[model samples]
Target: MTPHPAPQSRGVALFDLDGTLVDTTYLHTLAWWQALRRHGHTVPMVRIHRAIGMGSDRLLDAVLGPDRETGEDEALSDAHGTLYATWYDSLQPFEGAAALLRATAARGWRVVLASSASEEEVAAVRARLDADDVIDAATSSADADATKPAPDLVRAALDTVGAEPEEAVFVGDAVWDVEAAARAGVPCVGLLTGGTTRRELEDAGAVLVHDDPLDLLRHIDAGPLARPPAPGGTS
Candidate 1:
């Protein structure tokens, strides 16, 4: 069960970007792999995908481990930014993702995007989602002191929307996202739209798991996301 209030409830909806919205986890993994290989580290895609939700700095360290010493977190980030920027024009929103956000926004929930992507990448995705008017605000790793699996990013997003923990819900695909949202005191709605398995997402802290965005949209009302009808009418 989602601990946070429903969509019509007085709260903000904080969302994770990469896999949750844009379906680009594998792309991110490949991009990081290319970046690492350019610097002489040959990491497998399978390992890199699991770490896709983490920011580039953390992903590099996670992939490269603590053994290799390099001060190029900035350089690698720059390379990724340059490479990933090219995909913005081609990025596609996941099924029902835009509608879900819009519906929640219409229902009185303030929508905010919380991502672990770089500033450049987050901007690209925002452009792709093009939900600027509907989205109350957005938070990226650039806006946070730490990355996902840490509560800072979620806290920043909540602050941006000016919503308290009890007044919000976080939706995401990764286990780290679950942990982060948990630390921030928000319920996590897990969607298996990304590459991760349902069992993994459920075990991570997802009270309700759905097949994808469309599945979630269909069940929003009865699934604990439907708040009491709004003031004038039902949301």
Candidate 2:
């Protein structure tokens, strides 16, 4: 048997689940709107959509304003959780999602998932991929001190995979993900699966933009994700 080269031994590919790996950003937007409506907060879907990448706490604050008392946060987040639960299977991983992860693993790269999603929600999402064979480690907001655009979440993911900040690349669909990756000093790759525009992602610090996880998967073997092909396949 051929030896498996460990691409991830030194650097890992960190992923943001929602817009980055799955097509659940808009679903999350609707869920948040319903959750807020249940609380009489009535946030607009557009704003909710814009805030989808943020963890519930940050999203609530973004839509509800910083003036909201910290005490109300837990209840609101719970409501959103219930609302989001209705769509557990509504979300499907983007094209090439599993392949991206598995291929990364095949290349000996450690694959880690980092998201603002709660533990249960993230578990459901990961279960859909069934990439237990590929994913090396994972982190969710439930385990992080802060969410995206802050680098805390990304750092948590790297730490989970026992990776260093400089040796990883983060992929996400939101401007905040780009910002967070930049802050963490990791290169950012943008996925258009989220609602954020290419310009916005670039402005936030994404250097490359792809259609989705699949696109990244197809191109990854060529870039920082690993060394070049093993050979004999270019023919």
Question: Could you estimate the TM-score for every candidate?
Answer: 0.90, 0.89
Candidate 2 regions exceeding 4 Å error are 1-8, 228-235
Candidate 2 displacement at residue 96 in angstroms? 0.7
What tens-digit string does per-residue lDDT give for candidate 2 at 1-235?
A: 0012234255577888887787888888887788778777877799888887887777777888889877878888888788878878767888899888877777666678877788888888887777766677788776677886788888777777556776677888998898888888888889899989888888887879887887787798666665422222111
User: Once superposed on the true structure, which residue ranges of model 1 sit more than 4 Å away at CA?
Assistant: 1-9, 228-235
Clashing pairs in 1: 7-225
Give per-model CA RMSD: 4.9, 5.3
Query: Which ten residues in a row are the worst by lDDT in model 1?
Result: 1-10
* Cα lDDT tens digits for candidate 1, 12-75: 7788989898878877777778887877778998999988787666777788886657687777
lDDT of 2 at 168: 78
Top-scoring candidate (lDDT): 1
Q: Clash number for every model?
A: 1, 2
User: Relative to the unseen true structure, what is the Cα RMSD of model 2?
Assistant: 5.3
Q: Go through the candidates in order and give each one's C-alpha lDDT.
A: 0.78, 0.77
